[model samples]
Target: MKQQILFSFSLFLLTFSSFYYPINTASTAPASSPKLAPAPKSPSPASSKPLVPTLPDTSDSTTPDDITKILKKAKTFAILTRLLKTTEIVDNLNSQLITAKSGGLTIFAPDDSAFSNLKPGFLNSLNENKKIELLQFHILPQFVDSNNFDSLSNPVETVAGKDPLKLPFNVESLGNSVNISTGVVNATVTGVVYQDNKLAIYRLDKVLLPLDFFPSKVHASAPVAAKAPKADDHKDKSSSAEDNEDGETTQGQKKSGAVSFITIEGTRTMLVSLGVAFVAVAMI
Candidate 1:
Protein backbone atom coordinates (compact mmCIF):
# COMPACT_ATOMS: atom_id res chain seq x y z
CA MET A 1 0.00 0.00 0.00
CA LYS A 2 2.94 2.49 0.80
CA GLN A 3 4.72 1.87 -2.54
CA GLN A 4 1.58 2.67 -4.58
CA ILE A 5 1.03 5.99 -2.68
CA LEU A 6 4.75 7.02 -3.27
CA PHE A 7 4.45 6.26 -7.05
CA SER A 8 1.33 8.56 -7.35
CA PHE A 9 3.17 11.51 -5.61
CA SER A 10 6.24 11.09 -8.00
CA LEU A 11 4.03 11.28 -11.08
CA PHE A 12 2.27 14.53 -9.87
CA LEU A 13 5.70 16.22 -9.18
CA LEU A 14 6.99 15.42 -12.72
CA THR A 15 3.83 16.96 -14.42
CA PHE A 16 4.09 20.24 -12.35
CA SER A 17 7.85 20.59 -13.06
CA SER A 18 7.32 20.38 -16.87
CA PHE A 19 4.63 23.24 -16.96
CA TYR A 20 6.63 25.62 -14.62
CA TYR A 21 9.92 25.28 -16.63
CA PRO A 22 8.30 26.40 -19.97
CA ILE A 23 6.59 29.52 -18.38
CA ASN A 24 9.88 30.73 -16.72
CA THR A 25 11.86 30.33 -19.99
CA ALA A 26 9.38 32.60 -22.01
CA SER A 27 9.54 35.42 -19.35
CA THR A 28 13.45 35.44 -19.42
CA ALA A 29 13.71 36.20 -23.25
CA PRO A 30 15.27 39.62 -24.39
CA ALA A 31 12.84 42.66 -25.10
CA SER A 32 13.77 43.57 -28.79
CA SER A 33 10.17 44.87 -29.94
CA PRO A 34 9.59 48.54 -31.00
CA LYS A 35 7.62 50.96 -28.66
CA LEU A 36 4.08 52.16 -29.73
CA ALA A 37 4.21 55.99 -30.14
CA PRO A 38 1.21 58.38 -30.86
CA ALA A 39 0.61 59.05 -34.63
CA PRO A 40 1.99 62.51 -35.79
CA LYS A 41 -0.76 65.07 -36.67
CA SER A 42 -0.77 66.85 -40.14
CA PRO A 43 0.81 70.35 -39.84
CA SER A 44 -1.76 73.20 -39.85
CA PRO A 45 -1.84 75.29 -43.04
CA ALA A 46 0.52 78.38 -42.79
CA SER A 47 -1.34 81.57 -41.68
CA SER A 48 -0.14 84.70 -43.65
CA LYS A 49 -1.56 88.23 -44.28
CA PRO A 50 -2.28 89.51 -47.84
CA LEU A 51 0.02 92.19 -49.27
CA VAL A 52 -1.30 95.74 -50.14
CA PRO A 53 -0.38 97.98 -53.13
CA THR A 54 0.96 101.54 -52.68
CA LEU A 55 0.63 104.60 -54.98
CA PRO A 56 3.54 106.72 -56.21
CA ASP A 57 3.96 110.28 -54.83
CA THR A 58 2.78 112.46 -57.71
CA SER A 59 3.10 115.89 -55.98
CA ASP A 60 6.83 115.67 -55.30
CA SER A 61 8.48 113.66 -58.10
CA THR A 62 6.06 113.92 -61.03
CA THR A 63 6.32 117.73 -61.47
CA PRO A 64 8.90 118.73 -64.09
CA ASP A 65 12.30 120.08 -62.83
CA ASP A 66 12.22 123.11 -65.11
CA ILE A 67 8.73 124.14 -63.93
CA THR A 68 9.81 123.82 -60.30
CA LYS A 69 12.88 125.96 -60.92
CA ILE A 70 10.89 128.62 -62.71
CA LEU A 71 8.38 128.91 -59.84
CA LYS A 72 11.22 129.36 -57.37
CA LYS A 73 12.82 132.27 -59.22
CA ALA A 74 12.42 135.68 -57.48
CA LYS A 75 11.52 137.72 -60.53
CA THR A 76 8.76 135.34 -61.61
CA PHE A 77 7.19 135.36 -58.14
CA ALA A 78 7.33 139.14 -58.00
CA ILE A 79 5.48 139.44 -61.31
CA LEU A 80 2.92 136.90 -60.14
CA THR A 81 2.43 138.68 -56.81
CA ARG A 82 1.56 141.93 -58.55
CA LEU A 83 -1.03 140.15 -60.71
CA LEU A 84 -2.67 138.65 -57.62
CA LYS A 85 -3.26 142.07 -56.07
CA THR A 86 -5.94 143.07 -58.56
CA THR A 87 -8.54 140.33 -57.96
CA GLU A 88 -8.76 136.86 -56.35
CA ILE A 89 -9.36 135.14 -59.67
CA VAL A 90 -6.09 136.40 -61.14
CA ASP A 91 -4.17 134.79 -58.31
CA ASN A 92 -5.79 131.42 -58.97
CA LEU A 93 -5.00 131.81 -62.67
CA ASN A 94 -1.36 132.57 -61.91
CA SER A 95 -0.97 129.37 -59.91
CA GLN A 96 -2.42 127.23 -62.70
CA LEU A 97 -0.28 128.99 -65.33
CA ILE A 98 2.99 128.39 -63.50
CA THR A 99 2.24 124.76 -62.72
CA ALA A 100 0.77 123.92 -66.13
CA LYS A 101 2.55 121.34 -68.25
CA SER A 102 4.52 122.81 -71.15
CA GLY A 103 2.15 122.72 -74.08
CA GLY A 104 1.57 125.28 -76.81
CA LEU A 105 -0.90 127.70 -75.13
CA THR A 106 -1.90 131.31 -75.69
CA ILE A 107 -2.92 133.05 -72.47
CA PHE A 108 -4.63 136.41 -72.67
CA ALA A 109 -3.67 137.70 -69.25
CA PRO A 110 -5.80 140.67 -68.30
CA ASP A 111 -4.09 143.49 -66.40
CA ASP A 112 -5.44 145.45 -63.43
CA SER A 113 -6.43 148.22 -65.79
CA ALA A 114 -8.39 145.76 -67.86
CA PHE A 115 -10.40 144.67 -64.82
CA SER A 116 -10.92 148.28 -63.84
CA ASN A 117 -12.28 149.04 -67.28
CA LEU A 118 -14.86 146.29 -67.00
CA LYS A 119 -18.50 147.31 -66.58
CA PRO A 120 -19.62 148.13 -63.03
CA GLY A 121 -19.75 145.05 -60.82
CA PHE A 122 -18.68 142.85 -63.73
CA LEU A 123 -15.99 141.07 -61.77
CA ASN A 124 -18.19 140.72 -58.70
CA SER A 125 -21.10 139.44 -60.78
CA LEU A 126 -19.10 136.43 -62.01
CA ASN A 127 -20.27 133.41 -60.03
CA GLU A 128 -18.30 130.22 -59.44
CA ASN A 129 -19.97 128.41 -62.34
CA LYS A 130 -19.07 131.17 -64.83
CA LYS A 131 -15.50 131.55 -63.62
CA ILE A 132 -14.23 128.58 -65.63
CA GLU A 133 -15.76 129.92 -68.83
CA LEU A 134 -14.28 133.35 -68.23
CA LEU A 135 -10.85 131.84 -67.61
CA GLN A 136 -11.12 129.61 -70.66
CA PHE A 137 -11.70 132.66 -72.86
CA HIS A 138 -8.28 133.94 -71.87
CA ILE A 139 -6.53 130.63 -72.55
CA LEU A 140 -5.94 128.97 -75.90
CA PRO A 141 -5.29 125.29 -75.20
CA GLN A 142 -2.97 124.91 -78.20
CA PHE A 143 0.39 126.60 -78.08
CA VAL A 144 0.12 129.56 -80.44
CA ASP A 145 2.63 132.38 -80.89
CA SER A 146 2.43 135.77 -82.59
CA ASN A 147 3.60 134.20 -85.85
CA ASN A 148 0.74 131.67 -85.76
CA PHE A 149 -1.94 134.33 -85.41
CA ASP A 150 -1.95 135.11 -89.13
CA SER A 151 -3.12 131.62 -90.00
CA LEU A 152 -6.06 131.61 -87.52
CA SER A 153 -9.38 132.88 -88.86
CA ASN A 154 -11.62 135.43 -87.22
CA PRO A 155 -13.85 134.23 -84.35
CA VAL A 156 -11.52 131.48 -83.17
CA GLU A 157 -12.89 128.95 -80.67
CA THR A 158 -11.54 129.41 -77.16
CA VAL A 159 -11.74 127.28 -74.05
CA ALA A 160 -13.99 129.93 -72.51
CA GLY A 161 -17.21 128.51 -73.94
CA LYS A 162 -18.94 127.10 -77.03
CA ASP A 163 -19.55 130.55 -78.49
CA PRO A 164 -16.25 131.14 -80.25
CA LEU A 165 -14.74 134.62 -79.85
CA LYS A 166 -14.16 136.28 -83.19
CA LEU A 167 -10.44 136.94 -83.37
CA PRO A 168 -9.89 138.60 -86.71
CA PHE A 169 -6.26 138.45 -87.78
CA ASN A 170 -5.54 141.75 -89.50
CA VAL A 171 -2.23 141.71 -91.37
CA GLU A 172 -0.85 144.91 -92.76
CA SER A 173 2.39 145.62 -94.63
CA LEU A 174 4.11 146.40 -91.33
CA GLY A 175 2.80 143.59 -89.09
CA ASN A 176 -0.32 141.73 -87.97
CA SER A 177 -2.89 142.85 -85.40
CA VAL A 178 -5.58 140.74 -83.62
CA ASN A 179 -9.12 142.12 -83.44
CA ILE A 180 -11.98 140.52 -81.56
CA SER A 181 -15.06 140.59 -83.69
CA THR A 182 -17.86 141.42 -81.18
CA GLY A 183 -20.26 141.72 -84.04
CA VAL A 184 -21.67 144.78 -85.86
CA VAL A 185 -22.30 146.69 -82.62
CA ASN A 186 -18.98 146.48 -80.81
CA ALA A 187 -15.55 145.07 -81.59
CA THR A 188 -12.69 144.49 -79.16
CA VAL A 189 -9.12 144.07 -80.32
CA THR A 190 -5.95 142.62 -78.81
CA GLY A 191 -2.31 142.60 -79.88
CA VAL A 192 0.09 139.73 -79.18
CA VAL A 193 3.33 141.24 -77.91
CA TYR A 194 5.11 138.66 -75.76
CA GLN A 195 6.02 135.04 -76.43
CA ASP A 196 7.56 132.48 -74.05
CA ASN A 197 8.03 128.73 -74.13
CA LYS A 198 4.58 127.25 -74.89
CA LEU A 199 3.00 130.59 -73.91
CA ALA A 200 1.87 133.73 -75.71
CA ILE A 201 0.66 136.92 -74.00
CA TYR A 202 -1.60 139.45 -75.64
CA ARG A 203 -2.36 143.04 -74.59
CA LEU A 204 -6.08 143.59 -74.91
CA ASP A 205 -7.79 146.99 -75.15
CA LYS A 206 -10.85 145.85 -73.17
CA VAL A 207 -12.12 142.94 -71.13
CA LEU A 208 -13.72 140.52 -73.53
CA LEU A 209 -17.45 140.03 -73.06
CA PRO A 210 -17.94 136.94 -70.94
CA LEU A 211 -19.07 134.00 -73.08
CA ASP A 212 -22.45 134.39 -71.38
CA PHE A 213 -22.88 138.00 -72.53
CA PHE A 214 -25.00 137.29 -75.63
CA PRO A 215 -27.62 134.55 -75.68
CA SER A 216 -28.35 134.69 -79.43
CA LYS A 217 -24.79 134.02 -80.54
CA VAL A 218 -21.80 134.29 -78.25
CA HIS A 219 -19.45 136.86 -79.87
CA ALA A 220 -20.86 136.14 -83.30
CA SER A 221 -21.64 138.89 -85.80
CA ALA A 222 -24.32 139.28 -88.47
CA PRO A 223 -23.48 137.97 -91.94
CA VAL A 224 -22.12 140.50 -94.44
CA ALA A 225 -25.42 140.51 -96.33
CA ALA A 226 -27.30 141.58 -93.17
CA LYS A 227 -25.02 144.58 -92.61
CA ALA A 228 -26.39 148.11 -93.21
CA PRO A 229 -25.85 149.64 -96.67
CA LYS A 230 -22.99 152.10 -97.10
CA ALA A 231 -23.69 155.86 -97.20
CA ASP A 232 -22.28 156.30 -100.72
CA ASP A 233 -24.40 153.47 -102.10
CA HIS A 234 -27.61 155.15 -100.81
CA LYS A 235 -26.78 158.53 -102.47
CA ASP A 236 -25.83 157.04 -105.86
CA LYS A 237 -29.05 155.04 -106.29
CA SER A 238 -31.31 158.02 -105.39
CA SER A 239 -29.57 160.37 -107.84
CA SER A 240 -29.55 157.84 -110.71
CA ALA A 241 -33.33 157.18 -110.37
CA GLU A 242 -34.20 160.91 -110.31
CA ASP A 243 -32.21 161.61 -113.46
CA ASN A 244 -33.86 158.72 -115.38
CA GLU A 245 -37.37 159.87 -114.43
CA ASP A 246 -36.72 163.49 -115.55
CA GLY A 247 -35.38 162.36 -118.93
CA GLU A 248 -38.43 160.15 -119.56
CA THR A 249 -40.84 163.03 -118.74
CA THR A 250 -39.16 165.44 -121.21
CA GLN A 251 -39.18 162.86 -124.06
CA GLY A 252 -42.85 161.94 -123.50
CA GLN A 253 -44.00 165.58 -123.53
CA LYS A 254 -42.22 166.26 -126.84
CA LYS A 255 -43.76 163.17 -128.55
CA SER A 256 -47.33 164.10 -127.45
CA GLY A 257 -47.45 167.79 -128.50
CA ALA A 258 -51.14 167.59 -129.63
CA VAL A 259 -52.24 166.86 -126.01
CA SER A 260 -53.23 169.93 -123.82
CA PHE A 261 -50.30 171.25 -121.72
CA ILE A 262 -51.99 170.16 -118.45
CA THR A 263 -52.98 166.79 -119.94
CA ILE A 264 -49.51 166.37 -121.46
CA GLU A 265 -47.83 167.18 -118.18
CA GLY A 266 -50.11 164.77 -116.28
CA THR A 267 -49.61 161.93 -118.83
CA ARG A 268 -45.84 162.47 -118.92
CA THR A 269 -45.67 162.64 -115.12
CA MET A 270 -47.51 159.31 -114.72
CA LEU A 271 -45.25 157.56 -117.27
CA VAL A 272 -42.15 159.08 -115.57
CA SER A 273 -43.40 157.94 -112.17
CA LEU A 274 -43.89 154.38 -113.48
CA GLY A 275 -40.39 154.29 -114.97
CA VAL A 276 -38.84 155.65 -111.75
CA ALA A 277 -40.77 153.01 -109.72
CA PHE A 278 -39.35 150.24 -111.98
CA VAL A 279 -35.77 151.52 -111.49
CA ALA A 280 -36.14 151.68 -107.73
CA VAL A 281 -37.61 148.14 -107.69
CA ALA A 282 -34.72 146.78 -109.75
CA MET A 283 -32.13 148.45 -107.49
CA ILE A 284 -33.45 146.60 -104.44
Candidate 2:
Protein backbone atom coordinates (compact mmCIF):
# COMPACT_ATOMS: atom_id res chain seq x y z
CA MET A 1 0.00 0.00 0.00
CA LYS A 2 2.85 2.47 0.76
CA GLN A 3 4.46 1.95 -2.65
CA GLN A 4 1.21 2.65 -4.53
CA ILE A 5 0.77 6.01 -2.67
CA LEU A 6 4.32 7.26 -3.51
CA PHE A 7 3.97 6.65 -7.29
CA SER A 8 0.67 8.53 -7.51
CA PHE A 9 2.12 11.62 -5.77
CA SER A 10 5.17 11.72 -8.04
CA LEU A 11 2.99 11.63 -11.18
CA PHE A 12 0.95 14.63 -9.85
CA LEU A 13 4.14 16.70 -9.25
CA LEU A 14 5.51 16.12 -12.80
CA THR A 15 2.28 17.27 -14.44
CA PHE A 16 2.21 20.55 -12.48
CA SER A 17 5.85 21.45 -13.36
CA SER A 18 5.29 21.01 -17.14
CA PHE A 19 2.23 23.32 -17.22
CA TYR A 20 3.82 26.26 -15.15
CA TYR A 21 7.14 26.50 -17.20
CA PRO A 22 5.43 26.90 -20.62
CA ILE A 23 3.03 29.69 -19.36
CA ASN A 24 5.91 31.82 -17.88
CA THR A 25 8.02 31.67 -21.10
CA ALA A 26 5.11 32.98 -23.19
CA SER A 27 4.59 36.08 -20.87
CA THR A 28 8.40 37.13 -20.98
CA ALA A 29 8.68 37.33 -24.86
CA PRO A 30 9.01 40.94 -26.57
CA ALA A 31 5.99 42.49 -28.40
CA SER A 32 6.08 43.87 -32.06
CA SER A 33 6.29 47.87 -32.34
CA PRO A 34 3.76 49.87 -34.49
CA LYS A 35 5.13 51.38 -37.83
CA LEU A 36 5.96 55.24 -37.94
CA ALA A 37 4.33 57.51 -40.61
CA PRO A 38 6.71 58.84 -43.30
CA ALA A 39 7.87 62.56 -42.89
CA PRO A 40 6.09 65.08 -45.26
CA LYS A 41 8.14 66.08 -48.36
CA SER A 42 9.77 69.65 -48.42
CA PRO A 43 10.05 71.74 -51.63
CA SER A 44 13.60 72.33 -53.02
CA PRO A 45 15.15 75.81 -52.69
CA ALA A 46 16.02 75.99 -56.45
CA SER A 47 12.41 75.29 -57.53
CA SER A 48 10.72 77.79 -55.06
CA LYS A 49 10.32 81.52 -56.03
CA PRO A 50 9.22 84.64 -54.04
CA LEU A 51 5.89 86.25 -54.85
CA VAL A 52 6.07 89.59 -56.80
CA PRO A 53 3.79 92.67 -56.21
CA THR A 54 1.69 94.33 -58.90
CA LEU A 55 0.90 98.02 -59.67
CA PRO A 56 -2.63 99.46 -60.15
CA ASP A 57 -3.89 100.64 -63.56
CA THR A 58 -4.17 104.38 -64.32
CA SER A 59 -5.60 104.24 -67.90
CA ASP A 60 -9.13 104.90 -66.67
CA SER A 61 -8.35 108.48 -65.54
CA THR A 62 -9.93 111.46 -67.31
CA THR A 63 -7.88 113.53 -69.77
CA PRO A 64 -7.52 117.35 -69.70
CA ASP A 65 -9.76 119.66 -71.76
CA ASP A 66 -8.22 121.24 -74.89
CA ILE A 67 -9.83 124.03 -76.94
CA THR A 68 -8.32 123.18 -80.31
CA LYS A 69 -9.14 119.55 -79.82
CA ILE A 70 -12.70 120.46 -79.03
CA LEU A 71 -13.07 122.63 -82.14
CA LYS A 72 -11.39 120.10 -84.35
CA LYS A 73 -13.73 117.39 -83.17
CA ALA A 74 -16.69 119.61 -84.05
CA LYS A 75 -15.52 119.60 -87.72
CA THR A 76 -17.39 122.82 -88.58
CA PHE A 77 -14.89 125.18 -87.01
CA ALA A 78 -11.98 124.61 -89.36
CA ILE A 79 -11.60 128.23 -90.35
CA LEU A 80 -12.19 129.39 -86.82
CA THR A 81 -9.62 126.91 -85.59
CA ARG A 82 -7.12 128.26 -88.12
CA LEU A 83 -7.81 131.80 -86.96
CA LEU A 84 -7.47 130.80 -83.33
CA LYS A 85 -4.09 129.21 -84.00
CA THR A 86 -2.86 132.05 -86.23
CA THR A 87 -3.82 134.63 -83.61
CA GLU A 88 -2.62 132.41 -80.72
CA ILE A 89 -5.92 133.11 -79.00
CA VAL A 90 -6.34 129.43 -78.25
CA ASP A 91 -3.32 129.63 -75.94
CA ASN A 92 -4.70 132.75 -74.30
CA LEU A 93 -8.09 131.12 -73.77
CA ASN A 94 -6.52 128.01 -72.29
CA SER A 95 -4.33 130.05 -69.92
CA GLN A 96 -7.27 132.22 -68.99
CA LEU A 97 -9.34 129.14 -68.19
CA ILE A 98 -6.66 128.09 -65.72
CA THR A 99 -6.23 131.47 -63.98
CA ALA A 100 -9.69 132.96 -64.48
CA LYS A 101 -11.10 134.65 -61.36
CA SER A 102 -14.63 134.63 -62.65
CA GLY A 103 -14.13 130.91 -63.31
CA GLY A 104 -15.31 131.13 -66.90
CA LEU A 105 -15.12 132.63 -70.41
CA THR A 106 -17.60 133.07 -73.25
CA ILE A 107 -16.53 132.73 -76.88
CA PHE A 108 -18.60 133.88 -79.85
CA ALA A 109 -17.10 131.57 -82.43
CA PRO A 110 -17.77 132.19 -86.12
CA ASP A 111 -18.18 129.12 -88.28
CA ASP A 112 -16.53 128.43 -91.66
CA SER A 113 -19.70 129.44 -93.45
CA ALA A 114 -19.80 132.69 -91.54
CA PHE A 115 -16.28 133.49 -92.71
CA SER A 116 -17.27 132.61 -96.27
CA ASN A 117 -20.03 135.21 -96.14
CA LEU A 118 -17.44 137.95 -95.59
CA LYS A 119 -16.15 140.04 -98.51
CA PRO A 120 -13.12 138.88 -100.51
CA GLY A 121 -9.68 139.50 -99.03
CA PHE A 122 -11.39 140.57 -95.81
CA LEU A 123 -9.14 138.51 -93.55
CA ASN A 124 -6.04 139.43 -95.55
CA SER A 125 -6.93 143.10 -95.35
CA LEU A 126 -6.57 143.05 -91.56
CA ASN A 127 -3.11 143.65 -90.12
CA GLU A 128 -1.68 141.35 -87.45
CA ASN A 129 -2.82 143.64 -84.62
CA LYS A 130 -6.27 143.97 -86.16
CA LYS A 131 -6.60 140.20 -86.47
CA ILE A 132 -5.82 139.79 -82.81
CA GLU A 133 -8.33 142.46 -81.91
CA LEU A 134 -10.89 140.83 -84.20
CA LEU A 135 -10.47 137.57 -82.35
CA GLN A 136 -10.54 139.25 -78.96
CA PHE A 137 -13.71 141.05 -79.96
CA HIS A 138 -15.49 137.69 -80.00
CA ILE A 139 -14.35 136.72 -76.52
CA LEU A 140 -15.68 137.89 -73.20
CA PRO A 141 -13.58 137.75 -70.08
CA GLN A 142 -16.60 136.45 -68.16
CA PHE A 143 -18.82 133.51 -68.91
CA VAL A 144 -22.26 134.27 -70.32
CA ASP A 145 -24.92 131.68 -70.91
CA SER A 146 -27.61 131.77 -73.58
CA ASN A 147 -30.35 132.20 -71.03
CA ASN A 148 -28.55 135.14 -69.41
CA PHE A 149 -28.33 137.30 -72.51
CA ASP A 150 -30.81 139.82 -71.11
CA SER A 151 -28.85 140.13 -67.88
CA LEU A 152 -25.96 141.77 -69.76
CA SER A 153 -26.09 145.54 -70.22
CA ASN A 154 -26.21 147.16 -73.63
CA PRO A 155 -22.85 147.97 -75.26
CA VAL A 156 -21.21 145.12 -73.36
CA GLU A 157 -17.44 145.32 -72.98
CA THR A 158 -15.16 142.69 -74.50
CA VAL A 159 -11.51 141.67 -74.47
CA ALA A 160 -10.91 143.86 -77.52
CA GLY A 161 -11.44 147.25 -75.94
CA LYS A 162 -12.47 148.86 -72.67
CA ASP A 163 -13.77 151.99 -74.36
CA PRO A 164 -17.48 151.69 -75.21
CA LEU A 165 -16.95 153.55 -78.45
CA LYS A 166 -14.32 151.27 -79.97
CA LEU A 167 -15.60 147.68 -79.91
CA PRO A 168 -19.02 148.47 -78.53
CA PHE A 169 -21.77 145.85 -79.00
CA ASN A 170 -25.35 145.36 -77.92
CA VAL A 171 -26.92 142.12 -76.70
CA GLU A 172 -30.67 141.86 -77.08
CA SER A 173 -32.85 138.85 -76.38
CA LEU A 174 -35.97 138.19 -78.38
CA GLY A 175 -37.59 135.27 -76.55
CA ASN A 176 -35.30 132.40 -77.53
CA SER A 177 -33.31 134.27 -80.16
CA VAL A 178 -30.30 136.42 -79.21
CA ASN A 179 -29.17 139.24 -81.47
CA ILE A 180 -25.85 141.07 -81.30
CA SER A 181 -25.46 144.51 -82.85
CA THR A 182 -22.26 146.54 -83.30
CA GLY A 183 -23.89 149.50 -85.16
CA VAL A 184 -21.96 148.28 -88.20
CA VAL A 185 -23.36 144.75 -88.47
CA ASN A 186 -26.15 142.78 -86.81
CA ALA A 187 -25.73 139.09 -86.07
CA THR A 188 -27.91 136.52 -84.32
CA VAL A 189 -26.66 133.73 -82.13
CA THR A 190 -27.55 130.64 -84.13
CA GLY A 191 -26.71 127.94 -81.65
CA VAL A 192 -24.43 126.82 -78.85
CA VAL A 193 -21.18 125.21 -79.97
CA TYR A 194 -19.96 124.12 -76.57
CA GLN A 195 -20.77 124.80 -72.95
CA ASP A 196 -19.23 123.85 -69.64
CA ASN A 197 -18.89 125.31 -66.18
CA LYS A 198 -15.57 126.89 -67.10
CA LEU A 199 -16.29 127.86 -70.69
CA ALA A 200 -19.16 128.55 -73.07
CA ILE A 201 -19.01 128.85 -76.88
CA TYR A 202 -21.73 130.12 -79.14
CA ARG A 203 -22.27 130.21 -82.91
CA LEU A 204 -22.79 133.45 -84.78
CA ASP A 205 -24.42 133.82 -88.15
CA LYS A 206 -22.40 136.94 -89.07
CA VAL A 207 -19.10 138.32 -87.76
CA LEU A 208 -19.57 141.20 -85.36
CA LEU A 209 -18.14 144.09 -87.36
CA PRO A 210 -16.92 146.69 -84.86
CA LEU A 211 -17.17 150.40 -85.59
CA ASP A 212 -13.37 150.43 -85.75
CA PHE A 213 -13.67 148.49 -89.01
CA PHE A 214 -16.91 149.79 -90.55
CA PRO A 215 -18.37 153.18 -89.70
CA SER A 216 -21.80 154.55 -90.68
CA LYS A 217 -21.91 155.65 -94.31
CA VAL A 218 -22.58 159.33 -94.84
CA HIS A 219 -23.08 161.13 -98.19
CA ALA A 220 -21.00 164.26 -98.65
CA SER A 221 -21.13 167.23 -101.09
CA ALA A 222 -18.21 167.81 -103.45
CA PRO A 223 -15.28 169.64 -101.83
CA VAL A 224 -15.49 173.41 -102.51
CA ALA A 225 -13.10 174.50 -105.29
CA ALA A 226 -10.17 176.57 -104.07
CA LYS A 227 -11.11 180.29 -104.37
CA ALA A 228 -9.33 181.80 -107.41
CA PRO A 229 -6.32 183.92 -106.40
CA LYS A 230 -7.33 187.64 -106.63
CA ALA A 231 -5.30 190.23 -108.62
CA ASP A 232 -4.68 192.25 -105.39
CA ASP A 233 -3.31 189.10 -103.67
CA HIS A 234 -0.79 188.58 -106.52
CA LYS A 235 0.23 192.25 -106.35
CA ASP A 236 0.78 192.01 -102.60
CA LYS A 237 2.98 188.91 -103.00
CA SER A 238 5.06 190.69 -105.73
CA SER A 239 5.56 193.77 -103.50
CA SER A 240 6.65 191.51 -100.60
CA ALA A 241 9.30 189.91 -102.88
CA GLU A 242 10.62 193.36 -103.99
CA ASP A 243 10.98 194.48 -100.37
CA ASN A 244 12.91 191.25 -99.55
CA GLU A 245 15.33 191.99 -102.45
CA ASP A 246 15.89 195.57 -101.24
CA GLY A 247 16.69 194.31 -97.74
CA GLU A 248 19.33 191.96 -99.24
CA THR A 249 20.91 194.87 -101.18
CA THR A 250 21.05 197.00 -98.05
CA GLN A 251 22.90 194.21 -96.17
CA GLY A 252 25.45 193.94 -99.04
CA GLN A 253 26.11 197.73 -98.99
CA LYS A 254 26.71 197.67 -95.21
CA LYS A 255 29.23 194.81 -95.65
CA SER A 256 31.08 196.78 -98.41
CA GLY A 257 31.27 199.95 -96.21
CA ALA A 258 32.69 197.93 -93.32
CA VAL A 259 35.39 196.49 -95.71
CA SER A 260 36.42 200.03 -96.88
CA PHE A 261 36.68 201.29 -93.27
CA ILE A 262 38.92 198.33 -92.36
CA THR A 263 41.22 199.07 -95.40
CA ILE A 264 41.64 202.77 -94.43
CA GLU A 265 42.49 201.88 -90.82
CA GLY A 266 45.11 199.33 -91.99
CA THR A 267 46.76 202.02 -94.23
CA ARG A 268 46.93 204.49 -91.26
CA THR A 269 48.58 201.77 -89.15
CA MET A 270 51.24 201.23 -91.90
CA LEU A 271 51.97 204.96 -92.13
CA VAL A 272 52.48 205.27 -88.35
CA SER A 273 54.95 202.33 -88.44
CA LEU A 274 56.97 204.01 -91.26
CA GLY A 275 57.09 207.30 -89.27
CA VAL A 276 58.40 205.46 -86.19
CA ALA A 277 61.21 203.80 -88.27
CA PHE A 278 62.32 207.19 -89.75
CA VAL A 279 62.56 208.77 -86.26
CA ALA A 280 64.65 205.83 -84.99
CA VAL A 281 67.11 206.22 -87.97
CA ALA A 282 67.61 209.93 -87.33
CA MET A 283 68.34 209.23 -83.62
CA ILE A 284 71.00 206.71 -84.67
Please tell me which predicted candidate would have the highest TM-score against the true structure: 2
Give the runs in model 2 whose Cα sits over 4 Å from its true position.
Answer: 1-64, 215-284
Q: After superposition, how far is residue 1 of candidate 1 from its true place, in Å?
A: 99
Cα distance off (Å), candidate 2, residue 49: 71
Q: Please provide, for model 2 over 1-284, each residue's C-alpha lDDT reduced to its tens digit, 9 standing for 90 to 100.
A: 88899999999888988877656765688876889999889966651222111112211123225677767766778988998898888897888887776758888878789999999999999998988888888888788866677778877888886555556688877666788887668997877766657777787888877777754321121235689989999899998998899889898889998999999999999999999999999999
Q: Give one digit per residue, the lDDT tens place, for model 1 in 146-203.
A: 5555555545666654443443222121133344543322323344334466555555
Q: Cα lDDT of model 1 overall?
A: 0.52
- Per-model C-alpha RMSD: 24.2, 25.9
**Clashes by residue pair, model 2:** none
N/CA/C clash count, model 1:
7
Kindly give the stretch of ten consecutive residues in candidate 1 with the minimal lDDT sum: 49-58
